[model samples]
Target: MSRKVIVTCALTGAGDTTSRSEHVPVSPAQIAADAIAAARAGASVVHIHVRDIATGQGSRDVALYREVVRQVKESDVDPVINLTAGMGGDLFIDPSNPTVHLPGTDLVSGLERLAHVEELRPEICTIDCGSLNFGEGSQLYISTPDMLREGAARIRELGVKPEMEIFDTGNLWFANVMVEEGLIAPPPLYQLCMGIPYGAPADPGLLKVMVNMLPQGAEWTSFGIGRNQLPWVEHSVRLGGHVRVGLEDNLYLSKGVKATNAQLTERAISIVESMGHTVATPDEAREILKLDKVASA
Candidate 1:
């Protein structure tokens, strides 16, 4: 059966990719502009992560998030805004002294992480379901059961859909527990994040297992980082799921070729169309995800 895929553009992740690619947006205006461009290029949703304007690193500043959301809402194209509530969970431990928190650590309460989400009230926000080793460094992403519960409850209360981000099988398992515990409502939305270090490897077998583990009738999408970004688009579509692409997962359109968010969205659209599948509009995506219509500003 043919399907209409919802293409989500994850603009500028919190990673340190600014130096690697000039296309990564750092300021709120740049991020909003890129999101609008991606929307015009056929993206139904825009996953956002604000950066420190001065340092070009990730930030949890509520004002920065406010400005980005404001600009996106004021734009002509109305893609579903998905803000990242995954910040404030980084736990950088001191290598020599494990008990000593390092400089990169930015741990905070779950409520503090959702401050922007509460104030902005975007249609969608992400909740990283569980903790992981994160990456090659001594850094660890901390999302305990209590933290997930608090985040999920608050997101539910705000009437915003929680896009559960599953980094590994354990995260997926706890996400199911969140649903069973009645924190998340029906028609859950999930983003199967593959190819990250120390988590689920970006493999077809792993994707198949993760996809099967999703709640019945759930709306899901999958992505792979770096070289696997484009390939995973085809994999997701073939596996009866949606697709995500942007500078967040990859910096290059091809080897030695930098790519903008709009360029990535266009590429994803081309792939979907080539497979005899239509790309869903923002309104169509809202319908498919069962999200209430967000009024235009």
Candidate 2:
């Protein structure tokens, strides 16, 4: 076990989970409150993804992001806010037509995608390196090389730390290429997303392979969705990487047990401590991620 680890709470994901858990924050106020609660429960960072209130679906709207960021910052909780720039890249292609997009496809330009990050200027923002066949079938989260480079360049220009999100080995390769091209800043931040079907599995062996592929001295945190959440928390920290947890990834504390964001974060903290590792506080995480102490927004 490492001496110290940082726990991040992914408050509410863009997933279809509003109906699954009563604790999943739908409104901006609820999202912010859940984030603050996660911080109070021992998370040093809160990874956020805002949703449309009426529909309770994922969105890439700048106004939604602004509201969420504002509320989290204004709250007494000082957990490092990490916004998701992963939206606006969905490509549910028309299989029959092969050229046209399906109903759910929501592809936008790299500039449009990063507009929220540019506006909010959070401590950290995610830049998905490449696209992949998401889920079991019929959906694809498309992020081309040109688009990835453009997103990375924009994040670098805005002076916001880009948390390079790697879903598979190719994404990692593209990230390394970005590091070489100077699109990504030095000592980069990474989030190894595992076990989302068609991408890397949540297996410990696969996690190790991905961790080994990271550039030397890179700071990374890893998380798996659903059942893999808690197990990967221990897997990440044991491999000298940090951990992320919360309702966005998994809804249960145990069998049929609905968990709030704070409950998940608290559980991750316990795992970290049980391994003889200390979970980083907000201040410690700030220094570790090289984040600005104050938000520019």
Candidate 3:
């Protein structure tokens, strides 16, 4: 743990966790406030996913994204913005038909998912590398090679770094293929998502294997959902990678304590610090990721 680790705080995920935790930010203003607070708490980057205010469900509306980004930009802190382009891929297949999607399904082309990234032009945008049986029941997350290729090209053109989201080994394989095909830029970023039902398990050995599989000079991060979140922070740092934590992945700060975004961020910083490693500031993270300097800085 010699180098500074970039801690990303995912404010409010596109999940149905609002009912689970009262701290999950819902409105554009709340989300923006959470981002600022997390940045102040030592997060170098803020991974944002806006929710529909009325239903507390994930949304791909560019207008909603616009408002969130706008508020953050005007705020005091300067954490790097990483918008989630992973929303438009939710697919809830009907149990009976198997072909038709369920009520909560929201499937679209890869390029369509980048509407916010295109308009907002955040420093970093995510590309969920491949499809997955994301969780329990009939839900799936879709992202074909064709869709990914097009999305990568568009993000590259937009001059935003693509944080390759790898749920399993296959996703990593396809991400490498995209990099080799020249769609992804140099020093590609990856996010190894663990403990998500049907994806990779939350095993240290497996995370090491996935980390080894990353292309040379690639910067990556990993996170384990639920109770594994905090432990995964230390795991990622010890493995020479960055880390992410927030209410999006887990709700608890302790055994029964519901955590706020800022509290989760502070706790993550404490973990990194206790491990003899310093946490990166917003500017340092940008330099580490090779992202552009902030405008009017």
| TM-scores of the candidates in the order shown | 0.97, 0.96, 0.97
Model 2, 131-206: lDDT tens per residue? 8989865788888999888888878778788899999989998899999888877678889999887888888998
Q: Model 1 over residues 1-297: C-alpha lDDT tens digits? A: 778899999999999999999999999999999999999999999999999999999999999999998999998999999999999999999889999998989999988999999899988999999999988879999999999998899888888899999999999999999988988866888999999998899998899999999888898999999999998999999999999999999998998899999999999999999999999999999899888732221
User: Would you list the C-alpha lDDT of every candidate in the order shown?
Assistant: 0.93, 0.86, 0.92
| Full-model lDDT, candidate 2 | 0.86
- Per-candidate clashes come to 0, 0, 0
How far in Å is the alpha carbon of 159 misplaced in model 3?
Answer: 0.4
**Model 3 regions more than 4 Å off:** 293-297
- Name the lDDT value of residue 27 in candidate 2: 87
- Candidate 3 on 1-297: residue-level lDDT in tens? 278899999989987899999999999999999999999888999999999999989899899999999999998888999999999888898888998878988898988899899888999999999989977899989999999999999898889999999999999999999988988777789999999989999999999999999999999999999999999999999888999999999999999999999999999999999999999999999888888632212
Point out where model 2 deviates above 4 Å. 293-297
